[model samples]
Target: MAQAARLDIMSIAALVAFALTLGARTTFCEGISCGPGWEAFSSSCYKKMVDPNGWLGARFHCVLEGGDLVSFNSSAEEDFVKGKMGARSFWIGLSNLECNHKLCPQVSGKELKWSDNTLLNHSNWATVKVASTNLESCAYVLPNAHKDYHPGKWRKVSCESSLAYMCKRSPDGCQEGQPCNKTAGLALTPVQTSACDPGDFLRGHFCYRFENTKKTWQGAEDDCVLWGGHLASVHSREDGDWLIAHMEDNFHVGLKKNIKMFEWRDKTAMDPALWYPGYPSSDDCGRVSRTGQVYNHQCNSLIVFTCQKGVDVTHRHHQAHLVCAHLRSFSHPCSPAHSTSAAPRLE
Candidate 1:
């Protein structure tokens, strides 16, 4: 009997714990409690009193309880309060004390700006005119059926008339300047680098290279010029280092084949001094093989070729048909020499 009783007690305790856990996830709306004519918005409560008080007096009332007159931005927000509080007229936080004489003069004094700072402009006014006499020279916000202002409009009204007024209390349920930190049990981590890098110029992170033997050095240079780039030249040691590191073992630089005679495309009468050591003499012109191996070939042999700039680290197999420099000052205009009439082979 004692064992059965112990099991029953354990079951009861488990049920109570489960109920508490479920209750923790539920949100309750207690509605506004500020007198009979007030409405609630989320956690804060608002009331529209029928006793017409001047704007200054209304503001003072709100301030006394650590609150302020309501300032609304969107139709949804207005409708939300109206739906909750039911149709009633109320005084809002707007007044026409500044620039009152001008046609459609804006009420200038905004004690605080909303996050979007839209209320600072005060342009969304209702079109109806407030009679000069009723012109408490102020504006009141209305709600529900009595909330009959033109949609997307505002109206100026009098402060002395006994109309319901709105009151908004801070949702924190605490006084200002008190610490209201909620994440007492949690921690946050910092990011080490920005999500993106700055100064990245390459498109699709790629560079191109081109090859030609049908033209003389001058003609070849012209071909490059027409294509918006010059003969690919290394601008800095960093560039050279990148090329050396990324290039395949048998890659060619700038040599051309002429019936077994080899020469640099730049046409400088030097002893092929620029050729990286054991290169150029292996063949006269450059050609990238099917396996991406670069070697010197006879110039007369019309092997379709081009020089490429940088290699894309992400995709090593992809090759560029033409290489171009990213110039700093002068912009170069070059178009592809080959026509799109013929489909390109992947190899």
Candidate 2:
């Protein structure tokens, strides 16, 4: 009778433990749930920025909000975006300028790819023929006849043009103790100020380091890549000013001039404003002037160059967590049950 009573107590204890565990899990899920303004779909959350801006501006805006421009991985994703899009067009995170042949002017090749480097298996390009040119290389959504309500279709547009943009993020971004940005609809780790790794200087979420050790234009690019980054690409005047103010000497930027043409290492057009007056039309590499203006220098000229490493490592890590969580939620691995002997052997 005492043994049976003890057994009953153990069972009750087990039930209580299970209840506590289930409640804890439920609380955790609620804690990490997407906050206001962000629409939840699957394991991810998304938000659309209403203000129109240039492609780079839109991209930067999304980054500041702790996400990137939206990129669809499947038809369901595309459909979700369409539903959010309504009748208005917006920018999606799709472009080839970063990996296109325009970067290597000397190398003969024709390749257009996405900025995120997603493998190409699906696309919803517009049927209408739009002239393909370097000027309008960035991708955007256009109207299509697939469905009257879902008018979003894909096409290239000039990156300089202003347009509304969308962002996609995952809920796993909410690290422990981090408060959610309910207004932006992101449950993300607090956006920290740019911090550089040892031997690098923080510059607006990018870590920059000037290597006085001279190398050719291509050699500099290779070195930067080996160091896990690329040659610096100056975007805003503020960026250029910062580089000029911080550098003791003129340094090569990612820009390379071959023949009479100039392009960034990523094959994107270097903003003409970055060039010093009467610059270019020369066969050489690009260098930052003391005044922050850009000028062409001989490609073989051994000169100091700056490298820029991104501070988005956390974003990538959180994305990996989201992928893992999705897989685990949907998959059930086989669990071997413990075998019971027909009867305990008399010992």
Span of 10 residues, lowest total lDDT, candidate 2: 100-109
lDDT of 1: 0.35
Model 1 deviation from native, Cα RMSD in Å: 31.6
Q: How many backbone clashes does candidate 1 have?
A: 27
> Which whole-number lDDT from 0 to 100 does residue 103 have in model 2?
20
lDDT per residue, candidate 1, 225-344, as tens digits?
Answer: 565443433323433433332222223344555455654454433244344445555545553332322345554453333333232222211101111111111133222222222111
Model 2 TM: 0.36
Stretches of candidate 1 off by over 4 Å are: 1-44, 97-124, 128-136, 142-153, 174-347
- lDDT agreement with native, every candidate: 0.35, 0.53
lDDT of 2 by residue, 136-255 (tens): 245677432223222466755434334567876667653232222333333222111112333344343456666778888888888899988899987756667556554556778898
Best by TM-score: 2
Clash pairs, candidate 2, are 103-267
